[model samples]
Target: MDASSAGEGFTVALASGETVTTRQILLATGMVDELPETVGVRERWGTGVHHCPYCHGWELRDGHIGILAPGGEPFAELRVTLLRGWSSNLTLLTDGSASLDRPARQRLEALGARIDERRLRAYEDGPDGGYRVCFEDGEELPVAGLFVAPSQHQRSGLAETLGCGLDTAEPNPAPFVVIDSTSGETTVSGVYAAGDLTGPAQSVILAAAGGARAAYFMNHALAAADAQAALTAAGLPAGSDGD
Candidate 1:
């Protein structure tokens, strides 16, 4: 089903025909992983195909792992090279996209990783319960795990529908909401954004900071409203601070 957006507020019409609504919307939606257009890649997600080595590498320690270079030098090569600490059996699959510089290639070679210059054709579940990656050059490699560099985009369509802007960058270039540094307030009023939706290299600690900032602003707004009500009840100008 297609996600629709309208004025006042957006509604996600579920497949079961249900609608949810709210007055003040906060889009803390995270990111979407855009996979490479390759065969068998989609079928093995999480099980064999992965994006963040930091998230999945530990489980694959001391196993034969393959790193597929989709794009970007910083994230594609550098990140996989860093994963060498987890496993001595790492293979770099170039897939005929980008190549490494001298320093980068040396580092990869030093880690005892081999490079596959052949273009990736497809991936299939290995008979031994791992993965079999086939290249266009008729070369096949068996790996316990396969890592890919997926392009990440903000997962919230609601943010974009409400006129929230985006910031695109290298490594994993994608769109994300723009917000104030201190308040987590988006360009759209009454709408606050946080987490990876705001595109700020958000880890757990950073996400907590964003939530606190938004809470602070919302609390201040509510407090000001309460103060105004008290002033009105006491027959004083709301603008006056009892001076």
Candidate 2:
């Protein structure tokens, strides 16, 4: 559906080119990950390479887990910190740009996590479904799986096209659609956002719950509006509908 920007409320143009207007809208467009342009990464996305540690950590626990560090600053620190709990043999490849302050480094070292400030060259499949992360200096670290925090972008630009405000996803520079933390309402009135398009806590279960809440709030608002209109027609004040 084509989101319209020139009206009082939300409007969508369907495939048949017919415009449908509505009082409220819920945008669950989701997001897309901007992964590293390396061989074997895209091909083995869900298998060897993954995004969320909490989601895939238990499955790959006790294996030689590698954290492909690429994002700048404390993001890498946070990522490596979280991943260390999932595996004892944890290695954080700094990708040549991740700089952990003295205290952060000490904390990582204390946790038995190794910090390798090597530039990543490429990825290769190792024996028995393992992976070898090749560095520019010709060193390789073998691991069962890799976890990375990739930059995320909106899958569809409809939110921006409809004049929705966006906010930066912290620890990284990616901008997500601006939404109320409680109700998921966008800056533009009558338009709401949910799921990964709103924040970093992206998962099927969370998205589903977010969608349900957005729908609930939208429905409540619609019912209130209807009640108000009916009260106005009956020559009563808006809040008098409670009677």
What is the number of backbone collisions in each predicted candidate, taken in the order shown? 0, 0
RMSD to native for every prediction?
Answer: 4.9, 2.8
Write down the TM-score of every candidate.
Answer: 0.73, 0.86
C-alpha lDDT values of all predictions: 0.74, 0.80
Strongest candidate by lDDT? 2
Q: For candidate 2, what is the lDDT?
A: 0.80
Clashes of 2: 0
Q: Model 2, 47: alpha-carbon shift in Å?
A: 1.4
In terms of lDDT, model 1 sits at: 0.74
Indicate which candidate wins on TM-score: 2
lDDT by residue for model 1 over 101-151, one digit each (tens)?
Answer: 778777668877787767888998987788888988887899988888777
